[model samples]
Target: MNNPIPPRAKKIPHTLEIHNHVRIDDYFWLNDRENPEVIDYLNQENAYYKAMTAHTESFQKDLFAEMKSRIKEDDSSVPYFYNGYYYITRFEAGKDYPIYARKKGSLEAAEELLFDCNEMAKGHSYFQMSGLSVSEDNQWISFGIDTVSRRQYVIQIKNLVTGEILPYKIENTTAGGTWSADGMYLFYCRKDDKTLRADTIYRHEIGTDPSQDVKVYYEKDDTFDVSVYKSKSKKYIMITSESTLTSEYQYVLASEPTAPFTVFQKRTRELEYSVSHYGNHFYIVTNKDGATNFKLMKTEEGKTEKEYWVDVLPHREEVLLEGIDIFKDFLVVSERSEGLNKIRIMRWDGSVDYYLPFTSETYMAYTTTNLDFDTTILRYAYQSLTTPASVIDFDMITQERIVLKEQEVLGGKFDKNNYIEERIWATARDGVQVPISLVYHKNCKKDGTNPLLQYAYGSYGVNIEPYFSTTRLSLLDRGFIYAIAHIRGGEDLGRKWYEDGKMLKKMNTFTDFIDCSRFLIEEKYTSPVHLYAEGGSAGGLLMGAVINMNPELYYGVIAQVPFVDVVTTMLDDTIPLTTGEYDEWGNPNEKEYYDYMLAYSPYDNVKAQNYPNLYISTGLHDSQVQYWEPAKWLAKLRDLKTDTNFLFLDTNMDAGHGGASGRFEALKEVAKEFAFLFDLEKIKS
Candidate 1:
């Protein structure tokens, strides 16, 4: 077969000037989604990708099947008791969607179907149903559906007892609503049509037209987004407006749906906090008074002002207070210390305090599903690099645990003992130690001849836990070593770790990843000729920046829905996440941030140099990162790069940020990615 020629995007130079800096973008014309020429160009690139990899079609199919075979076709999640019923989400054999059901009082009771997503998704190419909220009486349920993949859901209600759907519908919502204590009204957040930001909170009375719903509150700050939810105590409905560095909350009595909401605290610059209700006080986790790692405080129900707050747990510099779960007798706290997750169990009366024991240093553990506040049973989940995920229920009094369910890896070929999982630290250019979690087959060697794939997402304080994956088994069995680099941009080590990697210090994220790659090569775990790197979204930005800095360090790279056109995207506030992310990427309206971002913006930094093999993907309907960012970046690379190495752009026409709404359908995307790596390595089954 002959190699296919890559698509050449027509150049129409468009000049943009901001902060006294000028840039000439030749492919700026591709940003218009409504233009037929833009669609034609995307289709041409799609065809080029198909033609270039046509020989790997069979291998890709087999790879997809191999990965899919490891999954249990008929599986149900562990049912949890909530509001007099046990709710379950189960998948049927050979189906694309899950079936949501419930049983009254006990698991042995007759099941009542809530939503058969397979049936609901029969006619749509893309489908998603989320934010399922059940009324207090259990006679009604509310859900949001999005068929276009843009995440703009339409909310609807259904009568669980009569099996009749409500006539009213709410559009352009954040997909879920909070039901009032009397179940008479629903409170939901509304999104702006253009930017897709949730900026308003509204209340909808049951059996009334949504157009007549009352606007309860509006968030005037463009940098902050709003959301509505019921307190865990079920006594108050909360409206929270939050930015990256600040937050403010309001609340109203759940029993009085028409009552006005009272402000718990006014928004102060750089003051970040969250509220939870228990008995007669509201518990807060906050970063007040320079508590960079956050601290727990409590205030009486009527005295929610900051002046009335008293310390429950004072600030600790080494530990990050992630969150808390409230109960009548006990308090569960989720914390992170020394790049590891810890779950602490403490009684309200201050008689007992302990932490759930975890054996692996590189594992992830967190509390889950303790909705009933009166119970002594505490449910949590645990997973490691080699171990499958397991859900365990613990009795707070007896210190006993029951394993409710463990993820079943089918095909009879999986054994935890066959793999080695460990954590290793690498010194960065600045002498800071970065953690890397690695897993490989026991038979693999550290001879530098082995192929290794390193991945990281160093942004938004998001920590990518070292968890098990059934899909990753294919790589391990194929003699591939997989690694997760716990770099500085994430909150892996604590709040300071994230703060040191953002704003003017953003370059640390890129350099830390490069240092980790070099460390792997220096340790003989993998050579530069066999090293592969992967990251998506902000992590994709890391991929772009590192390759620009040191392209020869990686043999191949996969960037999924990359946010490469940073400066341009940040300057335009009309984009979905631009305005709200000013603190994240920095406000480019300032000359200092503009110069710093342009210095590292991947698309702006493309130049004449030898490049590695690249596989880039995006969705046409992506609301978070526009598809044009990747399209334009690829065009620039094709025009400038001097190498003959392959560069492919794949555009998913039917999906959004998250590709393919189905469970099995999403696997095909992974298969394509794996095939790209295998083909480059000349590995064929």
Candidate 2:
């Protein structure tokens, strides 16, 4: 086959001036999704991607099948008891969606089907169901569905007793609604039509028209987003308004569905806190009073004020209190120390306090699905780079635990012992130690010839935990090492780590990644010619920035729905998540932030250079990072890049930020990516 000609997007020079600074964007006209020309350009790019990768089609299919074979096609999640029923989400063989069912009182009881998502998703190209909420009475279930993959769901209630779907629908919701104690009313969040931000909270009465749903609260601040949930204690219906650096909560007695909400505390700048209702008090995990690592505090239910809060767990400089789970007899806290997860179990009376035993230094362990507060059993999940995920239930008093289920890798070739997992530290340019968790086949060696795929997402304090991926085994089996770089701009090392990599110090994130790459090469783990980098969304931004700064250091890169046009996206407040993310990536309206962001913005920084082999994918309907960013990026790169290295753009026209919302369907996307890497290394299975 002849070399495919890449799509060259037409450049209609558009000038943008911000803070008295002038910038020229040639492909700005591609932003209009409604324009037929824009769609044509995207289709052309997709066609080019198909043509360029046509030779690898069989390899991609085999890779996808190889990865899919490891997955148990007919599988059910561990049934968890909630309310009066045992709920289970199971996937039938050959089905792309799950079947949600419940049994009354016991696991042996006859199952009652709540949602067969496969049946519901049949008509939609992109479908996702979120915010599944069962009423307190367990007689009704509420769910939100997004057929467009824009994260905007339409909530619908169903009568479990009668097996009838309600006629009313609440549109443009964040998905899922918190039900009143009587199960007569539902509280849900509504998004702004233009920005897609959840800015309003509404209360809907069952059997009533959704159009008449009462507006419970409206967040006037553009920087803040709102969400509603029933307290874990099931006593209060809570509404939380939060920004990147601040949070404020309000509550109404779940019994009083029509009552107005009372503020737990007013929003204070830089004061981040989350509330959970307990017996007579509200337990809070907060960064109050300069507690950068966050501390635990409790306030009387009657006195929901910051002044009334007393320390339950004092702030520890070394430990970051990530979250907490309250129970009738105990309090479970999720903490992170030295970039490792720790789950601490404590009795309410202080009779016992200990962390659950975790053997692996680079494993992830956290509390999960402990809805029944009356029980002594604490349910949690544990997984490592070499271990499959296991959901375990623990007896706090006896210190005994039982593994409910471990993810079954079904191809018969799987063995945890066959892989080696380890944590290594790399020294950054500023002399900081960045942790990297790695996993590879035991046969693989730490030689410069080994191919290493490095991944990281250093943004919004989102820590990418070291966890196992069945699909990743395909890479390991092909003599590749998978590593997770715990770089700054994430909470891996604590809030301070994130703070040091944001705002004026944001460049540390890019430099730290590049430094890690250089360190890996210098240490003989992998040479520049054998190293590959991958990141999605914000991490995609990391990939773009690193390639721009040190393109020669990587052989290839895969950026999925990357937020690369930083300055432009951050400057436009109307874009989804832009306004609320001011604290994450500073508000670019100001000259200082404008200058800092523009300096590293990948699309803005693309110049005449020999770039690495690139594979970029985006969703046309993506709400978070607009599809046009990558489209415009590829166009400019095609024009300016001096290298003959292959650059491919794949756009998922049917999906949004999350490509392909299916069990096995999503693996095809990963297969394409893996194929790109394998093809570059000339390794075909």
Candidate 3:
């Protein structure tokens, strides 16, 4: 590779004043997506990215091909029985989209095609199909389609028997719809035009014009977003409105679609709960009554108010009750404790209780589709860093387990025994222990000579599971260690873990990742020269903060769709996900929060100092973190940073928050990032 010139953004001074504090933004002009100048600057960055990495073009193609080769081009998912039909999703030999089909009773029955996304997406540059629901009579199917990739979907109906596309369509929706028992009406949530927030619930009659659909309910608060769905039992249609700190629900019988929704409970600040129905009562999982770790309660069907609630599973100090799945004669509770997930099973009569056994110390297991309430066999999914994802059906009665399907790694030399997975703890600055999950080839040593890649996303109480990835074989086979930092701000260790890393304590997330990185180097797993970091979205925020604070600790960093311009974006309520995020990141209108946000915001704090090599990515139509955020951040980084180390930006002009929609196409993006890291390490195939 040769020395190359980087793109420099023009400086236009823009002053922002709030609470008598003034800040200057030189690259603020880059935020206007409609401006021709902004588009030109982004294109120039893309060109520079290409020019700088032109030497590795062939290597990248090889990387892409290697990664794609692991995938089964024509593979089908395990069919699950739902509503008297067994549904399956499979990809064809040469298609980028999936074909959703179903069989009436058994696999021997004639297959019925519900949707072929490849046919529907023919003319669109960017496409996504979701929210597929079949009517009760099984004669009609309603689904949502998005062409622009901004997440705003249009609901379309089709007659399965006649194989004809209907004229009924609903626009600006959440890409989901629930059908009534009679299949005469569809209930869906509509998004606000400007904010793109799901704010209204509407009922659309099957053969009627969508313009005449009745508005069933509306959520007026900008802080709360709404969604509508039918319960698993198919008995009730529920409309729920939730915010970061609170939630409320309204329900109506599925038999009477036109009935007014009845409030389950009035909304209260700091109160959160979700309801599930089984038999004659409603089960509630909630944080009400100061249950920080959450608890389960029950109330009679007709008397579902706070006063009538009775404790079912009382709150435990160290255990976090994440969710509950109810069946006719049993209950499966998902709980987290000691930084690991556990599934608890109990009989309906409360006569017996036990937990499913798992052998792996660091792995992820979660409940899968169990639509029927009559089955004794519970279906779930499990995976580890060294194991491919597998679907298991466990019988609660006999404790027998069956492996329904394990993801096929097509080029078939893959073996679980060739790798090792371990869990280690890293002590934070405040003496808190954070868990780190790592995996490496059996041939790889714990010597400081090897390169390692660390990843984390410690925000929004989202726990980063050490799930298996076939694409990661490219790194492990080349002597690279892959690790996941289970830092704070995530619910890995319980709800308290998340509480300590958000709001004013958000800095803990950044420091936690850095501490884990240092721990790895100290343990002789890898040294600073060979240590690489990768994070996306909120985790991308982690990457930005760590790079600003300890640039010398990493050899290179990859931040995808980073939310770097935090203060500026949070202050603007017009953007999607901003207003509703006030609780997660405090409302900047307050003086205390405004000052605190400014101190850590990556864009506001980027200084004139030496920085690590960076490869950043974003999607032009991203609805979560706008592409301009990364674009402007890169512009400023190129202008102010003193280091001449490689800095590149790649923007997908046609995609949204999720890079590419196609299964094989998304692997290309991963190949590009891996190629960047490999090039920095001078590793060639």
Candidate 4:
């Protein structure tokens, strides 16, 4: 340990021939998780990382404490009325997890605890719960629990009145369950064990053994995953099967649990739509008929076919129809235009409709829990880079909006007025305008000497909204400019924005991010020597790409659970998310896509060049982007790169894609990241 040890990965060369092209992968042997050599190498990397950052260990703890102090440990969420109960999630002081409880009728009633995650998570290192579905009669509750951090869960029923756990437990589920109206049966989606894909829907009768559960529907397509949920209207149990590009749905009457589900629409390539049950028809948001930005359509209950569909909100060339929350008398639609999200509320009778106005130039407003369909009140949450998240209820009848609660920043020193959030557009090489959302301390100067951390996730149409984060205060207070690059791959601008950033045009996403960085540098926000970059998962792909393309442009980079070895990962259908992402990253089996992906694929494109100081992180049990991708990428970079810049890997042996499950424990990783950046910047404080 005293000899300045660095893990020199043993290369066992493996040749891969695809489309008549021979590629040599020297670190292919690292993918074997069971091999002791692999574990030894990873542990050595961890040891080296710890030794390298030992000087910042004290700083890391202080950063963690500073971040934790900003969060109110005993805070409770705003309760929302649902099914004759007011559901609330609150945390207890000194605890990591929350207590999910509800009141029978009013908030003042005696609290009935549904699940105490602190108690259930005591013995496990990783734990998560989902699908907390209460029965129609409120006598039974079904929930999905995952203890292994692999996204696979077991569905268990509980008797609320007697406070007893039921004997029936459905295993290998997707952590969701839909309870029928009569509470006689529960429907859940089952995952394929090997792929961890939710591919089948099953029905389990109350009081029956799980072994007796019936397989109601099977999604044989490897590229599609299935999910089951009861409609907000509570009249139908809907089952949806979807991939990156297409979606199909089937539904059954909630009162008739044994009845077969009828297909709402047949599946078609590149056609994506979602359904919501309403009075006598199903409201759908679809991208069919070349509606690139998508539009709203409605169909009769029995004649639920594409041909019979009629437009409710006609396709707009500019506005992207994101989603809709249906109510008895009003429909709240979430739409995006010019890279900003807005909410439009329309009355059922088509007499009144108007957009909800926001005061911030860059803010995120989305629908929260609106379980009651008959009410005039609409619940939504809003937040900006400078503003704490606020839970709001809007009255559709009177157009009055009430802020129920604004998140309390535990430390009294935090003031929204002391910060400024703004939006700017950067021009890409192709002349496409890329939007940038940034926030900084009001006292901070727009100087090129300031350190800037830019983040982006441009894949699978997942738009990275400019949301508030309490943990980010550490960086802002330290004079760091935090910016989000709304690059092309995401649906930030419109559906066309995503379409131009994927498949053959995928390079747009990478170059757009680089362009944004250059623009910031030119604008005096930060210079290349003071710039740092970060991204996770697919966004991590952006991090790897930018560093490879312009290594001298960044002072440091942090990639968390990165999907770096794209060409290799996509070539293997055995990977959990590979098959389902064919439409996103494109299938490498095709020669056209193979050449296009390899041109920018991070691992394959690692050449002998200088790279910025890097801190890469991965979870050993990550199912989404296998840990081997980043491990292989790191080994290759360390061997080929000519620079002596710092390169470190931190692997969580007991975690998965989401990292540590505990609230406080996850902050340690963030602290380590901040400490790494701070040390590189010579910021000892």
Alpha carbon lDDT of each predicted model: 0.94, 0.93, 0.92, 0.92
**Candidate 4 weakest lDDT stretch, 10 residues:** 1-10
The residue pairs found clashing in candidate 3 are none
Tens digit of lDDT per residue, candidate 4, span 286-335?
A: 99899999999999889999999999999999999999998888989999
Report clashes for each candidate as comma-separated counts: 0, 0, 0, 0
Q: Give a tens-digit lDDT track for model 2, residues 1-685.
A: 5787787888799999978889999998998999999999999999999988898999999999999999998999999998788999999999999999999899989988899999999879988998999998888889999999899999999998899999878999999799999999999999999999999999999999998999999999999999999888899999999999999999999999899899999999999999998888899999999999999999998898899999999999989999999889999999999999999989989999998888886999988898998999999999999999999999999999999999999889989899999999999977999999999899987779999999999999999999999999999999999989999999999999999989989999999899888988998889999999999999999999999899999999999999999998988888998999889988888888999999999999999999999999999999989999888888999999999998989999999999999989999999999999999999978
Angstrom error of the Cα, residue 485, model 2: value is 0.3
**Top-lDDT structure, candidate number:** 1
Q: Which 10 consecutive positions of candidate 2 have the poorest summed lDDT?
A: 1-10
- Tens-place lDDT per residue, model 1, 107-171, is 99999999999999999999999999998988789999999899999999999999899987899
Q: Residue pairs in steric clash, candidate 2? A: none
Q: Cα lDDT of model 2 overall? A: 0.93
Task: Look at candidate 3 and tell me the lDDT of residue 161.
Answer: 81
RMSD of each: 0.7, 0.8, 1.0, 1.1
TM-score of each: 0.99, 0.99, 0.99, 0.99
